[model samples]
Each structure stands twice: as C-alpha cells, then as structure tokens.
Target: MIRPRHILRVFLLTTLLTTCLTGLSACGFVGFPGVYKIDIEQGNLVTQEMIEQLQPGMSRRQVRFIMGSPLVEDTFQPDRWDYPYVIRNGPDIIREAQVRIFFEGDSLVDVTGDYLPSWANPNAEPQGSTESEETEEAKES
Candidate 1:
C-alpha cells in the first residue's frame, strides 16, 4: 500500500540523517586534533655537550666559533651563559636550543646573559661548595 513518493521520501530522509550524523561526528569533536600527540618524547632533549666543549679560558670569539650565538647571558655579571632546548613531534614538532658564555677581561672568561634567565637570583650559587678559595686566599693575603 506504500506509494512510490512515500518510499522515495523515506530513502531521502535516511540518507540525509546518515550524512548529517557523519558530519556532526567531526563537528562536535574536540581535543582530537592533539589527542594523538599526548606523548612528548624526551629523547630529543639535548645534553650539556654544548657547554662541555667550552673550555674555561676560551675567548668569546672562539666560543662563538665553536658553539654559535648563545641563547641567554647574565645581565649583571654578563659572564654566565644558559642554554635550553626542547623537542616535540618530528616534522610537526617543536625544537629549540640555547647557548650561553661568560667572559673575563676582553677574552671570554665567562658567559653572561645570552638571552635567558637574565633575571635569575644573582645571590644564588650553584650546588656544592668547600668554602671559596678566595676566602682562603684573602685570609693568607
């Protein structure tokens, strides 16, 4: 008893609903863009090799020749350097590296503010100490 028009209408309705459902599946979706990118591999992280190659007495020009421009240098001391790097996905990823060097006199004695942590606490000293040789030297002097 179904008419041809009624059958056509049902078929069209089902088709429209299926298409709408498929499209909506993507429209209402969120967090899916970066969902597959949750894992951040630490393998891409660079090591201190950059700084290790720099000898204590190397000049700024020599340092630059070896390590390129620094990422950061100290503001006040202008002798300590700091490098930071991070690596994300492969091609569609985030990767960066930083370098710092300090100087003494005209020669590069120490690396200072290259382009990072320029405002770090100046009073803070690195870990481990057996009383500075300066203290002993001063006492003897």
Candidate 2:
C-alpha cells in the first residue's frame, strides 16, 4: 500500500531538515555557549622584573644578555630597541606592554615605556656597588 507521492514527500522533508541544521551550525549557533579558545601570546615577554635588572651604562652585549634580543630594532636608529608583548583571547586583547631602550654610542643611556628601571629610585645605589670603600664604611658607621 506504499504510494510514490508519500515517499517523495518524506524525502523532501528530510532534505529540508538537513539543510536547516547545516545552516545553523555554519553560522556558529549550534555550539555557541560553551565553546572555548586558547589564549594566544605573541612577541617578547618583557616583564617588570626584567626592567628592574636594567642598568644605565651597560653595554649592548650586556643588555642583550640580560633582556634577550630586542623585538624591534630600527635600521636607521641602530641604538634604539623596542620590546613589545601581547596576549589575545579570540578577539579580546588581555595584556600588552612596550618598552623602548635608547643607547648613546654603545652604552644604554635611557629607557622609556611600560616599566621603570631600578636605578630610578632615589635610595637605590648605583649598580655593581661601584661606590668607594670609604663611602660604604662610612655608611656602616
């Protein structure tokens, strides 16, 4: 008692349902609420701790040894180096920092951007404890 017309109707209905389901998923609606994507991190991981280690009068090799190679070193401005870091989760940026190091001749002279150097503190003594022994002995007194 199977009719050809009834079989044709069922096939058309199934095809339509399949098409609708495919469209919904293609539009990002099927698994919309609970999906997760890993955060993406790019460029140098310049940190405050690293910046604190920086000292003026340090040579280029010393800076590179401490902070790693700069992410952006301008061709025309050979003495300037830029460190940039960023983290993104999908379309949202979670964190970012930029630090610029400037050199006079071969020595690091100035640093500007996200973090401050340790020597910026008034109480902080110059690095390497280059002060005279008498000054240190006097301070102990």
Candidate 3:
C-alpha cells in the first residue's frame, strides 16, 4: 500500500536523479562564454609580396631590407638564410611556411623550400639573364 508520504518521497528522488544526470552530462562543456584568444605569430612572417620584391642579383643588404633578417643564420653555412613563419591559435597550429635562400659568394643565387616564389616558374626567365643568353646564342651562331 502506497501512502501520500511515500508518493511525495518517490517524486523527490526522481527529481534529484534527473538533476544529477543532467549536470553530469553538461560537464563535457566546461568552456566559458564571451572569452576570446588572440593568435600568436612567431619567427619571420615572410609574405609572397615580400618575396616577389627579391631579385636574384640583390645584395645581402638589399635582401635584408626586402625580407628582413633571417630567423636562423648558421655560422657554418654563411651563404644560406632560412626564413620560417609559424602561426598558433592557442594549442593548435594555424599555418607554417619556410623559405630558404642560397647565396653564392655575395650574390643571391637560388631559393628552395616548402614555399614557391612569386616569379618561380619553368617558363619564367630571370631579369638580364635571358637577354645575355640570347646575345650569347647569336654570337655562337
């Protein structure tokens, strides 16, 4: 036989159990609202526009002026300059770009890395070299 007091107690227990289950389920999301995190940029942020300004014949001073000083300069490899850029949004990495420039003697010779220069293409000809090559070919013929 269920009395009114027993019914009241059962209802209270059911309500408490539902509340506990709801709270436990909500524990998965612990983040607060209205909070914002800023993205962090590290190392040299080399851009395509900056790379486009670089010419093969540009001096070290000129390259430094255009692309800024390299992040890593090895004493062993004085002619090799490495420019690396990394973006971080909290714990996750947003993007990374690495550009390596090689110099022969004092002149910038070539660039090879994960990034492609703006003017780097098989059909593209560097400034002054093509004209000199054409003149040389004519002379040879």
Candidate 4:
C-alpha cells in the first residue's frame, strides 16, 4: 500500500539525481582534468639550416629543392611564395612560423618572415670568429 506522497517524493529524488549526473558529465566537455588533447601540425616545415642553403641568385627550381614546396602561392602575385607552419594543442597554438620568398623572373630575389639565411641574419655570430678577435684585428688594421 504505497501512499501518493511517497510516490511523489521518489519521483522528485530521481529527477534531482539525474539532473546532477547530467550537469557533472558536461564538465568534461569544458576541458576538465584527465582529458586528452592531441597536437596538430599544419603547413610546411621550414628550418634555419634549409634557409641558410638559399642564395640570392638561385633559380626557382633550386629554391624549391631547398625549402620544399611553399604552402601558399598567390595567384595575383606569381613571384611570391609563402611558407607557413603551426602547431596546436587543442585550441591553443604552441608554435607558428612563416617564410616568404620572392622571385625576379627565374632568379630568387628576396626572403622574409620568421627565418633568414645565416649570412642575412644580423644577430648571428660570425662563423669561426669571436667578437674579441675581430676587435683585435680591427685595431691592428
């Protein structure tokens, strides 16, 4: 002999339990602990060593051989090629790099963006020469 009041109370408790469980399950979708995220890599991978191989007068074919195919080539600007790379962990970008190469006719003319040839990098230390040695040589000259 179940009373009407007892049935109503049981129904309310069940509804409340279900609601709480549903709410807790949604927390995982919002980046809760223990959630796994895979790193995503996109576009061409260009390295400083590859950039150093480039020379100002190299042909487009040589440039492509050293740097690989560019990620973007503008239709409106046929002489420009863009290489862009990115790594992401979920929605957060961990790393990004870009390089733009310009050609004049068949010859490579200019390069810009995240990397440059070692000869073109002003911040790069001169190979096999220390600053002190260079200063001493300058003083002698």
Give the winner by TM-score. Answer: 4
Q: Cα RMSDs of all predictions?
A: 9.7, 7.5, 9.2, 5.8
Best model number under lDDT: 4
> Candidate 1's residue-wise lDDT over 25-89, tens digit each?
97655434544554354322334554456566677777767666555566776766555555676
Candidate 2 TM-score over all chains jointly: 0.63
What TM-score against the true fold does each predicted structure earn? Answer: 0.36, 0.63, 0.59, 0.69
For model 4, the superposed segments whose C-alpha errors exceed 4 Å read 1-29, 122-141
How many residue pairs clash per model? 23, 0, 0, 0
Stretches off by above 4 angstroms in model 3 are: 1-35, 123-141
Model 2: per-residue Cα lDDT over 75-106, one tens digit each: 99999999998999877899988988999999
Could you tell me how far off, in angstroms, the CA of residue 138 lies in candidate 3 after the best superposition? 28
Candidate 1 backbone overlaps, count: 23
Q: lDDT tens string, model 3, 1-141?
A: 889999999999999999999897785466445667689999998877788787787788888998899999999999999999899976779999899988988888777666556465455567799889999999999
How far off is residue 35 in model 3, in Å?
A: 4.9
Q: What TM-score does structure 3 among the candidates reach?
A: 0.59
Better of 3 and 4 by lDDT: 4
Candidates ranked by TM-score, best first?
4, 2, 3, 1
**lDDT for model 3:** 0.84
Off by over 4 Å in 1: 1-30, 33-49, 89-100, 108-141
